[model samples]
Target chain A: MVAKLKDQMTPAERASALARGEKVDRLPCNPNIANGAARIYGCKISEFNTNAKALAEAQIAVYRRFGSDSIRIFTDLFTCAEAMGAKAILPEDNTADLLEPAISDLSQIDRLRPVDPYKDGRLPVQVEAMKYLVDAIGTEAGCSVGVVGPFTNSFFLVQMEKALQLICKDPEAMHKLCRISLESCKAWAAVVMDMGLTPTISEPMSSCTVVSPRVFREFSLPYLKELVDFIKSRGRGVTMHVCGQTNKIWTDLADLGIAGMSIDNVASIRQCKESIGDQVKVLGNVDPGSVMYAGTPMDVRLATLECIRDGYDSPKGFVVMSGCSLPVETPVENIDMMMDTVREAGYPIDIEWVEAEIARCKQVLGK
Target chain B: MRTKEELLAELARCVVEMEDDSVADVAREYAEAGHDPKEGILNGLIIGMNQAADLYDQEEYYIPELLICSAAMYNGLDVLKPLLPQEKQENEQKIVIGVVQGDTHDIGKNLVKIMLEAAGFTMIDLGRDVPVERFVDAVRAENPQVVALSTLMSTSMQNMGRVVQLLEEAGLRQQVKIIIGGGPVSTAFARKIGADGYSVNATDAVHLVRELLGA
Candidate 1:
């Protein structure tokens, strides 16, 4: 068989053009990188979670090996919470968990001090690491730092039960804690955006699965818009990510002041592209757990192709990425297959080939 | 100051509104009024908790919301437990629930526990990071009709299949149904691991349990 053509532009150019709503040479591919990078560095997730130098090194290593459009500096979701007095429990191979809340009660919302990224919590480790990532690849790649959203960070600070209780019992206190968490988010973002990298806000708890659209409208959207505006004002770009069941909140999230948005696997990418593709940049969402971790490299290829077809058929501003965190045990060969499919089958996707492939998928999927 | 029915409605309302602080007070009032604590609990608190669970299934309520509502439910239960009559059943449908070994993320498991309890299932919650042997031991001890397993990590999902294998070897597979859930779990995964049922969210786990147990 004769070779098919690939998109001509570089990944960085494709990413930049797509973010600006300009024509892209092809879809930019950035598999969701986080603790997944630890596997590449041959270190425990605890090392990546605790040590700044290792994190920066591992992040860069994955960027080089995987050939993603963006180099992300997201280690875990609890750094800001750790900064604000919530303790983090770092496991040997898994991501960190909240050991204890800084303030057990809502009464302490007022007493909560601001997180200084350099001085407070684990945010400084990330800041120093991201500086290294940007220094290494400032011009060659897209650099973005990750942080949890306001609602989630607040959950870490007050614990989960109180976080939900205050929402109904005292909206004022919940909003207050969310705002404080946003400040921590902004403080962390301020340090990294200063290095000219975009900030990818992974706000999983703000999704419709965790909150009603009514609650999301009340709490997450305003704070996110403010986060976007603040980042843009600093002369940097912004990317938003919410992990699961984001379909309910996509229209509103797409309308935010962001350069790109990452939707998880549960949401329909085709609908997202059709509804808001003209408005903003969309990234993501293959099932990071099953397809990337459990399935074979061929599975990754098929998923990548399906995602590309879904995105390409809709509009121009879509970047193929994982739906959520790529598991720490995700196969390197699977990553390669995903990138290969993007390069081989994505650009100028053959209509007959995709149709044939879809039929085969339905047959293989036993539908 | 209020009648029993009004206090019951108020108890349910506090849970629907996520008023963890006030549900306990309403329970106390209902008890102080010479109202049947069983009636107050059944009519007031569980009703509200069931409403919250429904809302959770509908995605209108989340982990946090359900967490507080359950707290309120327990508060009311604490006031009513001593007065309630001993319950009787011919064959009690028991359930053993826990996060499978190597998984520390228990919020999903906790939600499942609350929802199952609200649905009136007797649950032996082994809690998070429970070893595989502990599950077999729990089954042997409790003789549960079902074992509901949970995990948020794909890495720990391997343990679910192992538990099923251990059960088969121990000859308990014929006696008990096994169910699985968590963020990374799907219907396909549950099938792969020999789990009898799978639910994506906490609320549906109750429905799954009810269906599996013929409840």
Candidate 2:
């Protein structure tokens, strides 16, 4: 049997203490398990996403099984866009797919309206799930609802190809679309806060892999600042996850006054910690695809240990997590190994042992 | 009254500058000047696209710039392609590409298609959310030298492997080289799925295809 490290505090207490600039038992670990929760609870992705009880129960099962630091509620990135009238294909066993944008042209932007969390598309499904989770296990762990950032939601409204073209062809129209998307985000986030859950922002399209930093500043940054300020004004801390290479915008994103930032595995967590560790808490970046889904238990252990060694000492704080959301088919044992490694390493991580183990693991995993 | 050299330079500049509206005018000017339509495409618009690709490789231009440049290239192609002899229209190397089933994110796939087309390869674009059967069928129908599969979603990534298996079952796997790419895909994944290769970005994909074809 593998040895497991004991937790000295509950997940909620650990998370709270970490945010308050205090330390506790072990490193707070969250693998961004969202749709993957369905697998743990034995439900199809479609059933889990549409049914509030299934969503909440699956999340609870994940929390119970992994003792993860947070319960994340997110059906897909297109939830807000779908609510605003974009069409999507909901597969029986996979996440929803966007079929067509709400408006094909920016001229039709005026036809779109802000989404009402209670009344829009699947937004209500997400809200109801949050309600159930908070009611059931609110005090035991941190709960967050993943909301699409304005830039990505705007792309969903007009399709990414059109949105990118609009950036060079019609700047004003792009801004108008983003503004509408921003309001939708605020409206949905306002309701999440009302339920006492943090709203984590996801802006996959804003990553440097997709757009230039110049474009990000012109198109995504301003709207993100406004949304982050709105969330902070409500006295809630917010975190952001941008799903590709984001090293170019670390300084820009850090300037947004966000409480924490989730780094994608493609980017270096060590560089992120060195650059912005003082300004914001760093949560990330195990390779969700290579290490979590395709790797073995030992690979997860090595990757988790390597992440801790690199990020454990950030001045602001660090929460070990997957580089992005785990693929639904990720082996449960790999996730368990991640938690077990964090438990064994515990707080006041031994740099020497970690360093040696990292080398050995890298050699064993052929990194 | 511009000379042939002057006309070609303007054609290239129009594409590099993303002058989509003016590129057609420049190509028409080139065509009227009796400059070889093939020279206009190969030396003019294609050169500009390669320059833009260089900027992209250097990170000076990103997807938006690349998209607009490609649009300009296509506009220029619209004017010059019709003037070319039928033999000039055919390219020796043909490649079929698509985003695998259950994934609609095609920005990467489209970029690869543009770069491959600009590099003088004939491309049969299967578009986004293409089924595995379609890929196998396209392989049988087109008999292209290479097949490219892409997906942004991990859930749909398995379909790439399924496509490979289907092609093998259909006895068409040995007929073409298979390459895979996307956000979650890695070289290891390419190897695991028995693909011929994987490239991280669109620019490298051109070189990968060339190398795979031994061109």
Candidate 3:
């Protein structure tokens, strides 16, 4: 069955098409579909965070309605933490975050053990949701599963404040926590990849800009490399999403085993492409909150086009997207405007369209 | 009279000890020893605070440590301010700082506040989740030279922009440098929002503030 599907359009082919390195019918619209899906499917943000069924349904609806190539289900930050017996809080208006980890003391690490994703707490729900999604649309569309990075999980387990202290005070414990997070991540990645979907890890806290490069090297990169290799070894593609000015670390990330990077807007695309785009696929830099939330449709359009224009033109693996998660309240038309900008442009952005886009933005913002 | 080095050593000891009584005692000793208050702030308290900032950057200390040290510096400065000449007492540049509306993240803001104060800048912190009107009202009342706005979440970054625009509309923007910084704030976003300056990290924040103040 997989062979037959590959004969028609391979993963490389699909990746190539999205990257604009190869010619395709249209640009791939793959938003990091998260809580916005819940809002789209009429599930309250509260329910979306807490209820598995609501979360799954909303993700499906978002993929179907938006024609997105991929749908991201784990919108909340507390995925692996909750699985590890951390207390998580699901605020109605805010993102789901881990309240406290079960491992408050170094001695607790021995007591706490990794769980099978199918039998674990929220991990099971996420996997089950992915399985349902696979049965429904995974074969037809790209199904992306989100995983937390080692440092973030360490922060969750010991509580952020204590976790930060531990990183400086007890480097050994931090590494121990990272090891646990890495193992759990591999187990979790296996569950998602079994559904024949790609796996993407959101490394929100592991940015060199967030922590020192030395700390990242000590605490994050090793686990990241292990997890990326583990996921890829299972025959699934991996993309690591890091939120911050990580231009300095693009080469460091490329040196790791991930297939692609989803970087923030603060990091220069020209520099990232120059440094690591040849080796790995690069995904995003669109300012989601700035352009998608507040800017006019034209702002979205111009910025989207600029992302593609300044792109490495790596046809097979690049995916143009927002630098970070889509804000829950982001205007739908603004997203539409981004897609429209890309769709209107061919492989390369024509100069006339660039001028027209600039005009449109100026007109919208009245600048 | 003690040499400048002795006065500075005493001030450093006061910050490390972080007791109000010790800080006040050393502050009076420094003043009675005939050192300039502004010079004591620059050479003594500022050095200790920068050390704390360095400690934070190097992961040697955390927020609580910085806060307590800042409190110590403040305590010593309180005692020193009264004895100093009027001009020297007013020498520290005053700035207004706050987290923009709908954002409750104050840890980063307070870090900036402490670092600024440690750098010898007088800060009027409006605390977290500050409305735009309050920023403007504070600007009108306090007439600070720089208004530093902070927001952790990407969603509330718009409020920083709104505050800037509101200030601009009220014809107060030109009067103050609108600086925005936090986890989510980027230099490009700050430029888009028409902010005067943006810094990615805390140390850069101090430099940005000094540059804005032309100090």
Give the top-scoring candidate (lDDT). 2
- List residue ranges in candidate 2 displaced over 4 A: A4-6, A19-23, B88-91
Better of 2 and 3 by TM-score: 2
- The weakest ten consecutive residues by lDDT in model 2 chain A span A1-10
Grade the docking of candidate 3: incorrect
User: Residue by residue across A161-205, what tens digits does model 3's lDDT show?
Assistant: 566656655789888888888888888888777866677888877
lDDT of 3 by residue, B34-80 (tens): 77887777677777777777777776554445656677788877876
lDDT by residue for model 1 over B1-215, one digit each (tens)?
78777898998998777777777787778887888887887788889998988787776777667777888788778777777777786566789999998778788888888888877778899999899999999999999999999998776878899999999999998899999998777786787778898988888888888888777
Q: Which pairs, if any, clash in model 3?
A: A15-A316, A16-A316, A20-A315, A21-A315
Q: What is the DockQ (computed on Cα atoms) for candidate 3?
A: 0.21
Candidate number with greatest DockQ: 2
lDDT per prediction? 0.80, 0.90, 0.73
Candidate 1 residues lying further than 4 Å off, grouped into runs, are A1-9, A16-26, A364-367, B1-40, B58-60
Candidate 1 chain A worst ten-residue window by lDDT: A1-10
Q: What C-alpha lDDT, on a 0 to 100 scale, does residue A362 get in candidate 1?
A: 60
